[model samples]
Target: LPDVRSQDGFRASLDAIIIMRSNLYTVGRLIEAVMNDNEEEAMDCVKQGADCNQVNKHGAGAIHYVFTDLYLHPPLDLLSKMVANGADVNLRDYEGDTALNLAIKKTSLRPDNTMYKVVDQLMQWGADPTQKDLDGNDALALAENRKYLDIVKLLKKQKTSLIVPPPHETPVPSPRYQKSTTPYESRSPITHSPSPVHPDWGTPVLPAIRSSDPLIAPDREESITSAIEDDNTDELDALLNDPHANLNVPNSMGLFPLHVAILRNNPVSRNDMVQQLLNKGADINVKAIPNEDHDEGGNTPLHMSAARDQLDTVRILLTYDPAISPTNNEGLTPYNYAEQNGNSEMMRLLKEEQRNAERSNKSSTCVIL
Candidate 1:
């Protein structure tokens, strides 16, 4: 150690340890380090007095930019470092959003993103879920609003301790918390299928199919359609598992069970049912031929989701078939349907998906070349 710490000696020592720049200690370098997943350099900057909670021009910090799903590696590793370095988990951005809020918003683009892991870590580190953004939406509200049920479920488990202070007003209960009053039959275990029986469709209708095969019960077709429309996954599962169940059989209007599932508003269960049908070999790009009721043909499940402004379902379908761009009888692709319905969100998502598909094709072509 120096014998006497004169002002000049102190200045020299400070300059050696810290890079005094125009922004004092540029937080942009910290963000760039995170973006590149350079943990060692990020820690070095933090050790030399880089603001872990520093906000950029967009009022976002290193934490806000760490939720992406585009990287080859999980961003959680870098995120863990940020939190470990004493980054404020609950530090609000200019929009009053914490790191968790940004994670919830980005889930729309990549529903299969690592948001679940990111959110869990945030909560475990005492990120306050009750903190509202400028739009007066908390992490729970953002999750519910965006129809990210998985996040909602995760947040609900931590609700008891998430509140920093007693909330000024009681929050509205999300639909997931509501109990269903409709009676449901217990499903058989996954290994076996239940005997085919007419399911309760609330109203009796003439049998839609007449087949000698025991699996294709006359009334079962109508019942299965009803089950899909009503978001009854248990019955839907039973019908789907049966080897003879016509997964692609369209109804009187030429709409398949998958189409009906996409149109329904129940996201969590509807998504599950869609996945079940897909797993059981439902066509990913099946279209609804025009009928008197719905004169629009060439409308696949993707189109239905876009028309209904079901972004969650849209994302799910897009992940499976990003190249889908079939036009309906009216010569409208799913993007057109979104535009026709004035759903800007759906329009943006569909266009972005199309762009992604185009980029992927170009990449494939380049590899072949």
Candidate 2:
């Protein structure tokens, strides 16, 4: 080691290690590296002083991006590296899901050790399975439901569980949390099912809606529509496990569960409810067919949310990639709804998302070509 080095020389050497970029601390690169599953690049970023726990706008870090559905296994090798470098195992994302919750949700009974291994490794790394998701489902329930017996046994071994935080502690996902579902389809939803009971429209969910029941805790026997409108996240969460629960099925008044949920207004439960509905395959862009209530008819969930000036709800919906310009039967788009309410923020948000959608399309087109 050379002695008597100049202060300026020592400072320059430190800057060189970080690649002296315009942003200086380009931690965003670390997020990108993990998102693409590039272990080599991820390590390089860490070596150059990237914060392994650096979160995106959604409060999700490298660990949060490592999960996929049953068809793909989480990149545990990369996850291990991030955790070793001080990444948080329990950081909640926009969906209020910790890494453990995502792992269980994403895993299935594959031929061999393709997926279950991720769950084991996460548990070993101090992932607390007791941490409940937005809808109050924990890792144990998720694994048990899927019949991943190995994972269930592993969770059962841990005798301790966490008490869910109060509503004040519930994490709210910012607008940047990615919702990536394909926009509205022109086809109708799955209707005419008799086994699942329809909601009671007479018990209005919205303040100005047609029902009389006060928003309360979800009941053991609540219909999907009533559960949604009442912001009964617990009931809605339990119902999602039922293979027969169909959110797309419209009620007698032509209102789908998603339509009711947008107006539910229970801030604590509303976002989680919307997320649950979407995750269980609710159609993001389905329109309400014209009915006796023509004003309620011809509006998409987006239109309803906009008309109600529900900014947080709109942000959550926008993440799922709703069609910004889809016209209702009355030929009004979501933008028109925002405009009529004079919600300048919603209008601005809609415009920005429109630009983002256009850019995303171009990127997809480029990749396809």
Candidate 3:
């Protein structure tokens, strides 16, 4: 039948294969043991040829698991051991996130201030700061966005300075407006109105004839205006709906219904009232009724919204007409108002919208051409 020498050789070969498979299993168990925090067993397994750089199905190397999980805490001596034994420090996870980035994200909000240490360690170990996430945000940009001022400051200091050397001599542009040859002069002396005898009723007013032939006289002891004023939404609604209540009625200060609402400090109620009025077809672009005491500023709701930095209100008003610009008493537009208010976010949004509009105009022109 079979040759006796051939049978002996085949039996030896099978034994050798079994021993190799057993060694692989022992190596795998050692890695698992290390991950389980059994240091002695892990060392023995490592001695038996457990590859420290070996990754699981998810591409998470031994160091990745150590850094990302509770296998070992920082000071990272075990991590250093794995690294020294040939672990890939810069190995990426399934989402392409590096070990350092994941470490930072994990410890960013840690209560013990360990995040800074982790970040420092990463940086020292040559972690890339310029690497971008899926949203195109770099680490520095993300830190700034989340208001991590300290981290941002540190990162900025560590990075190469962006400052440029000033030119030796820069040319200045000539003034567009010509200077007046003659010295400026005051126009005229201002005259003051005669002082009133009584403070409450400053001046006597004549009864004016209405369209119904009724004379409207100033009433004595005008009701004290409360800061909360009145929530008289029902009355306002009725007046707004009424064909005869004169939607153009002005208060003593000559503030229109819309103007009064804008000037009020209570944003919540004022916004509600504004929305209600707008729902009843109130003119958002209505100019304030002019008064002798104060110029009504000719400010539309959009102008007021920008001045107050009410971004939501500004957005709503812009939806009606982004191009609408109500001039203030100083002849300043809403854009000017936004700049004066120091609303950088609002200013940026407005500028971006303006740029988009310009691009759209250019595209349309190209089509026409």
Best by TM-score: 1
For residues 96-161, write the lDDT of model 1, one tens digit per residue. Answer: 878788777773433333456667777888888889999999989998776554466567767733
Q: Which segments of model 1 are wrong by more than 4 Å?
A: 1-221, 366-369
Q: Give all candidates' CA lDDT scores.
A: 0.67, 0.67, 0.55
- Please report the TM-score between candidate 1 and the true structure: 0.40
Question: What TM-score do all the candidates reach, one by one?
Answer: 0.40, 0.39, 0.36
RMSD of model 2, in Å?
21.7
Off by over 4 Å in 3: 1-206, 209-229, 243-252, 289-292, 355-369
Per-residue lDDT of candidate 2, residues 85-132 (tens digit) = 787898888778888888777634233233355666777788878888
Tell me the tens digit of each residue's lDDT in model 3 across 270-354.
Answer: 6776676566555777765544434445766666667555666666655654454457676867777677645677787777777
lDDT of 2 at 171: 49
Q: Higher-lDDT candidate among 2 and 3?
A: 2
lDDT accuracy of residue 198 in candidate 3: 57
